[model samples]
Target: MLLSFRGAQHLRSWPYFYYRQKSHFDSAILLSNPRNLSQFSRAQPISARAMSTGRGALIVFEGGDRCGKTTQTQLLVQSLQSMGLKAELWRFPDRTTPTGKMIDSYLSSRSEVDDAAIHLLFSANRWEKRAAMLRALREGTTLVVDRYSYSGVAFTASKGIPSLSISWCKAPEEGLPAPDLLLYLELGAEDAAARGGFGSERYETLDMQQAVRRQFESLRDGSWTVVDAARPRDAVHEEVKAHAVEAVRRCAEGLEPLRALWSREPLA
Candidate 1:
């Protein structure tokens, strides 16, 4: 059944239904279909106090370089916070940490490292912050990450590094949090390149971006929501906001514990 954003909000008042984490931020809200709710020994309305014991949603923005992930990530965070939801913005290869510093150097061409090593470093950058990431989610703070393992594995694997296969690149990130909704800012290489051109980062080339796009395509499944990012900024934000609001609704029943990236099944 189609669930509206308001329908999810009303779940709190409707006492008959409750939600449980099916996996990660993906909660199985037993709304409209209450037959299977027998598993939940008790049915409690999902109020703020109830949410405090659970976690928040993990929303990720992924796309090729110059696809406006950073901008959209920030804007979505603002929107969520405006709605009184606890939301924060995070970026991968966070240049602030020690491992991130190395990743920054690698991206800026200031340092040279083996392909496999650098790929691991990028994954490590996320690992170092995994605890805090989990804490934020568990404490009812939604995380709007600018990038994630998808970018790491996609970008590195796009480079055709013989040793750094997709599976190998994903090994380090196996136990990290998985995004409940992966919004892929859909934009073609040429369109993305047209936007202020490419940056000086290592993977800013058109060829690399195309290959990364291919990788992203290969990684997509039901978890992904492709939004056409080639539209005007405001237009894109509208669509993103819609998706973000819906995600908050679906997860409003309270978040699930963070799970490993593609841990339950192999990533296609």
Candidate 2:
């Protein structure tokens, strides 16, 4: 027996008949031996409201420097569009805003910057983009963000700020937005060093980046995947796409906008 879904689980009106032997989520059933669904089954249509909760998945890719975040983000965005889905790509520290310019200067070593100031600035960058990000998700746009609040915390914490624990650093972004899927691209310090020389900027030192990588790892939990950046870009991309697609399927059932960054939860 086999079943194929005719429409969306709750949004589309259809009679799903799961085969006693084999079936798919499509709600259609095929049987090696015939079984009558209409005659001996309860087929009822469910409303769209009851199918799922939450909105599109908020996916963030964060890691140490030069982790192929931009390339992979573009791939995901283009792939999603090829699949006829509405997808948007956003990169943090947008570099278009005044605050972002300051950050760019600090990163380029063109200007002196206070560590604490840069930390908050990074947080502010995300905060500035928060509403747009949320609106995109609410409108059923799958958002692919490269670097987010995680970068703020991880990068800042790596700089030896006494009070800048990950949690402490993230407090300013508590109401920004939470990512449902976070992919932390992992690469060895030596590998990263060999790929390219660090930019002539503050925090671009090898030791600093290694420490930043450590901080990134410390923040890793079930919420993220440590992709081996040492692999070929395509191979890493395949792994990321597979995991991301599964996550998207699981999240699409709800299709409602989420308020994770603003669910009124106190700072962790």
Candidate 3:
């Protein structure tokens, strides 16, 4: 069954029956099979306080360098789209933006930036997309994001800069949209070194990667789903797909108002 929002005039094409709730937003819960109607009937209508009638799940992929986060994000987005769900792929350091261009220059070693400044630039890169990201989710476009604030914190804090504590690293990211599912692609340091094109970028060295991994471990919480990326690609994709599908289902039913990341507590 699919959950979507549609105007009354546009609901005639499908054989499915939907329970319509009229609000400031026209929200419709569509059940493909009539039998499911009873189940949906017993379910509570989505709260009016939600961002919209329905919002897409934010699924984030995070891990050390060369841990297959990029590959997994693409595959997961493809899988969701193939299932007829709305999904889009997003990534951090969106290098096309002006702020991102500076970050790109620093990461590529063409220019040097202060460690503290570079860290904030990374966070700013995401801050620039905050509005659009929220809009996509509210419009039912599930986002499969590669890297995020977690990467900013993990990579920057791994630098061991005296001023950049874990809590300080997390501060700028406080108000960003939190992911419904955070998938951490776990790979050993040795395995990550063996991956092709290792050390091609600023943070790809073994020592740096190891440090980043330690930082990620410290940041992990109960909300994270750790996947063993050493397995074959398809095997990892199956585990990711299962979690993503469940997250989407939960969001479609009703998502709490978008929450701020690390708003209430400092990272340990």
Q: By lDDT, who's the top model here?
A: 3
Candidate 1: regions farther than 4 A off:
1-54, 255-257, 265-268
Tell me how many clashing residue pairs each candidate has: 0, 7, 0
Candidate 1, 1-268: lDDT as tens digits: 2222344445444543323333223123322333322323233323444445445788999998889998999898887776557889999979999999888988899999988888888888998998898778777788899989999989888888688788887888887878878899999998888778586788888888899999999888887899989877876776676666556655656444455688754222
24-54 per-residue lDDT for model 3 (tens digits): 4233333344433343433443333332457
TM-score of 2: 0.75
Question: Cα lDDT of model 3 overall?
Answer: 0.79
| Cα TM-score of candidate 3 | 0.79
Clashing pairs in 2: 1-30, 2-30, 3-23, 3-28, 4-26, 5-26, 55-256
| Model 3 stretches with alpha carbons more than 4 Å out | 1-53, 264-268
**Per-residue lDDT value at 124 in model 1:** 85
Highest TM-score against the true fold, candidate: 3
Q: Point out the higher-scoring one by lDDT: 2 or 3.
A: 3
Alpha carbon lDDT of each predicted model = 0.74, 0.67, 0.79
Better of 2 and 3 by TM-score: 3
Give the per-residue Cα lDDT of candidate 2 at 87.
Answer: 73
